[model samples]
Target: MKIAVLGTGGGARAHIAKLAALGHEVHVGTRDPQATLARTAPDMMGNAPFGQWLADHPGVALHPFGDAAARGELVINGIDGRNAVAALSAVADRLAGKTLIDYAVPYRYDPDLEHPWPTPWGVMPAMEPVDTDSLGEQIQRALPATAVVKSFVTQEQTTVVDPASVAGGDHTMFVAGDDADAKRQTTDLLTAYGWRDVLDLGPLVCARGMEMYAHLHSAIGFGLGQQFGGHFGIKVMR
Candidate 1:
C-alpha cells in the first residue's frame, strides 16, 4: 500500500519508519519538506543510523506541499492534536474517496482536573455528547466523502509498535469506523504494524470510549511518574 504519513514530528516519523519496515511504499508528508529533513536528518543519523543510511533506498519518499497528499492510497494523520483538523484541511479535496486513518484527539490539554476529559467518556455540562458526535465525528463531517476510521489513539505509540515491551503485558487495540471494509483494511495495517490483539467496537461513535481510554491511561502514567513505562490493558475471560 502507498501510505502517506502527514506530519513532521516524532509521531509522523514513527509512522514513516514502521511503514518502511513493513515493506510498504511510504512517504513523509510535510508542508515544508526541507524543514522536516532538517530536523529529522540529525536525529535519524544518531538514533537510527542504519535507517538513515537507507535514506537512498527504495520504498520511502519525502514530499512537500500537495504532492504527498495526491500520492497516497491511505493517509495517516499523525499531526498534533490541535493542528490536525487545520493541517488535514489543506488536502481535504484530494482526500476524497480515500480511507483516511484518523489518529486525532481534539483536546485543548489545559490541565484542568474539573473536566471529565470530554464526550466519549462522559458528557460535557453545556455541550453536546462526544462519541459519533465527537471530534473524530466532526472531522468525518468535514470530509464526508472520505472514509474516516478512528483508530490508533487508544494506546501509546511505542505500545503499538511493540506489544511485548508494553508494561501491562498484552493490550487491546480497538477501532471505530462507519465502513466495515475500511475498518478491516485498517485492522490489517495495524496487524502489520505489530498489534496482536484487536477489538472492533462497532461504528465510529465508539471512538468516544477509545479516546477516554487515552485520557485515563495518560493520567495513570502521570501518577506513576511519567517514565513512559506505564500502561493499561483489557482482560477478557472466556
Candidate 2:
C-alpha cells in the first residue's frame, strides 16, 4: 500500500516511520522538498529536521504535496492545523475518491488573548470550528469527492502509531465519518497499528466532540506531570 502523509512534523514522522516499517510505500508530502531537506535546525516543537529523520528511514519517498497525494492509494492529512484545508484543497483532484484519514486539528494560536491558557510550548492554542464544526467536516466539504474520516485527533502523536505503549493498548480509539467505507478503512489501519478498540462514533459531526477534547487532552497531560505533552490513553469502559 502506498500511503501519502502530508506533513513533515513530528506527528507525521510517527506515521511515516510506522508505515514504512509495516512494509508499505510511504510518500511524505511537504510544501517544498528542497526547503524541507535544507533545514538545519529543529522545528517549532524542537523535532529534528526532516532530512535527518529521513536519513535514518530509507526507501521512503519524499515529494511535494500534490505528487505525494497522487502516488498514494490512501492519504493521511498531517498538514499543519491552520493550513490543512488550504494545502489539501489545492490537491483536490489528486485526493478524489480516496480514503482521507484526517488527524489534524484547527488550532488557532493567539498571543493577545484576554485570557490565555499557557502551556509548556507557550500558550495553549484555541481550536477553530471546535463546537459547531470540525476540521474533518471542513476538509470533507472542501473535497466532496473524497471520503474523509476523522481520527487520530484524540491521541498524542507517539501513542497514535503505537497504542501498546500505554496500558498495553487497552484504551479505545474513535472514528467518525459519513462514509462507512472510509471509516472502515481507517479502522483497518488502526488495527494494523495495534489498536484493540476503535469505536465508530457515527457521522462526521461527532468530530466536534473529538476536536473539543483537545483542550482537556492537554490538561490531562499537565496533570500527569508532563511538561510539554503526555503519553496516555483514553479508554471507554463498557
Candidate 3:
C-alpha cells in the first residue's frame, strides 16, 4: 500500500512506524520534513540509516505536502485536533475518491482552563467543550469527494498497537465511518498494524462517543498513574 501520513507528532510517527513495518511505501509530511524524517528514522529502522535509505530509494519519497498527498494510495491524518483541519487543507483535493483515515480528536486548548500544573498527580484542566463531531467531520465536509473514516482515537498508541505488552489478547479498537468501503480500508489497515479485534461501532457519529472515551481514559489515568496508555473492548454476555 502506498501510504501518506500527515503531521509530525507522536501519533503521526506511530502511523508511519506501523505502515512501514507492514512493508508499505510510506511518505511522511510535516512542517519540517527533514527534521521530522530524522526523528522518525530512529524509531522506524534501528541503526539502518533510514534517511539515507529513503534518499537512496528514489521510489520511496518523503516530501513536504503536495508530493506526499498526491502520490499516496491511502492518506492518513495524524495531526493534533487544533491544527488538523488547517494542516490537511492543502491535500483536500488530492484525497478525492481515496480512503482517508482520520485519527484526530476535538480537544481544545484554552489558557483560562484551570486544571493541575506539574505535580505528582498530573491533570489537565477541562477546557472548552469539543464539537463532538471531531475534526474528521470538518475534513469530510471540506473534501466531500474523499471518503473519510474515523477510527483509532480510543487508544494511546501503546495500547492500540501491540496490545500484548499490556493485557488482554487482541484488544478491540473502535471504527466509525459513513462509507462502507472506507471503513473496510481502515479496518484492514488496523488489523495489519496488529489490532486483531476491530469493533465497527457504526457511522461517523459514533466517533463522538469514541472521543469522549479518550477524555474518560485521561481522567482514569490521572487516578491510576501519570502515564495512561490503554484500550477498551466490548464483552457480550450470552
Candidate 4:
C-alpha cells in the first residue's frame, strides 16, 4: 500500500522505517521538504536531523504536507501534538475520503507549572484539551470528511511498531474512532504491525481516556528510572 506519514520527527521515522521494511511505499510529509532536508541539527527530542536519517533510508520520498497526503492511499499522522490540527487541517482536501490513523497527543508544555514532572531531557509536557476534549476529537472536528482514528498514543512509538519485542507481544493495543470502518482499517494496519490484542475502546469520545494515559505512561517510565518511556508495555487483563 502507498502510505503517507506526515511528520519528520522520531515518531514519524519509526512508522516510515517499519512501513518501508514491510514493503510499502512510504511518503513523508513536512512543512517544507527542502527545509526539512536542509536541517543540520537534531530535533528538540535530540533525534538526528531528518536529512541524516533520510540519507540512510533511500526508498522513502519527502514532500510538502498536502502533496504527501494527496499521494497516499492511507495516511498516518505523526505530526507533533502542538501543531497537528492546524497542519493537517490545511491539507484536509487531500485527506478526504480516506482513513486517518492519528497517534498524536495534544501536549501543551508549560515551563511555569506550579508542579511539573521532570524528565532527564526536560520537564514533562502537559496534555492539552485534556479532560473534556482530546486531540483525536479535535482533528475529527477539523476534518469531518476524513475518518480519524485515535491510536498508538498510550506508548512510545518504538514499542508501537515492535510490540513483540516486549513481553512476547502479550500486551494490548487500543483504537478509538467514530467510524467503524476506519477503526477496522486501523486494526488491519496494527495487525500488519504484529499487534494481537487490539481493543476497540468504542467511539472517538473514549479517546479522552487514551490520551490521558500519557501521564500514566510517563509515571511508569519515571518509576522504572529509564529515560525515553522506559521501553515498557501495558496489557489489559481480562
Q: Relative to the true structure, how large is the alpha-carbon lDDT of every model? A: 0.69, 0.93, 0.68, 0.92
Q: Which lDDT tens digits does candidate 2 get at residues 122-201?
A: 88888887677888999999999999999999998789999999999999999999999999999999999999999999
> TM-score of the candidate numbered 3?
0.79
Number of the candidate with higher TM-score, 1 or 4 = 4
lDDT of 1 by residue, 1-238 (tens): 8888776555566677677887788876777766555553445213433245347556678786357767988888776666666777777887888888877666554343564544332433222234446667767877888888988787666556555566444667778899988899899888887677778889888877766666566567667766342455554433
TM-score, one value per model: 0.77, 0.98, 0.79, 0.97
Candidate 2 TM-score to native = 0.98
Model 1 quality (TM-score): 0.77
Give per-model CA RMSD.
5.9, 0.9, 4.7, 1.0
Question: How well does candidate 4 score on lDDT at residue 131?
Answer: 85
lDDT of 3 at 94: 72
Model 4 residue pairs with clashes: none
TM-score of 4: 0.97
The number of clashing residue pairs in model 1 is 0
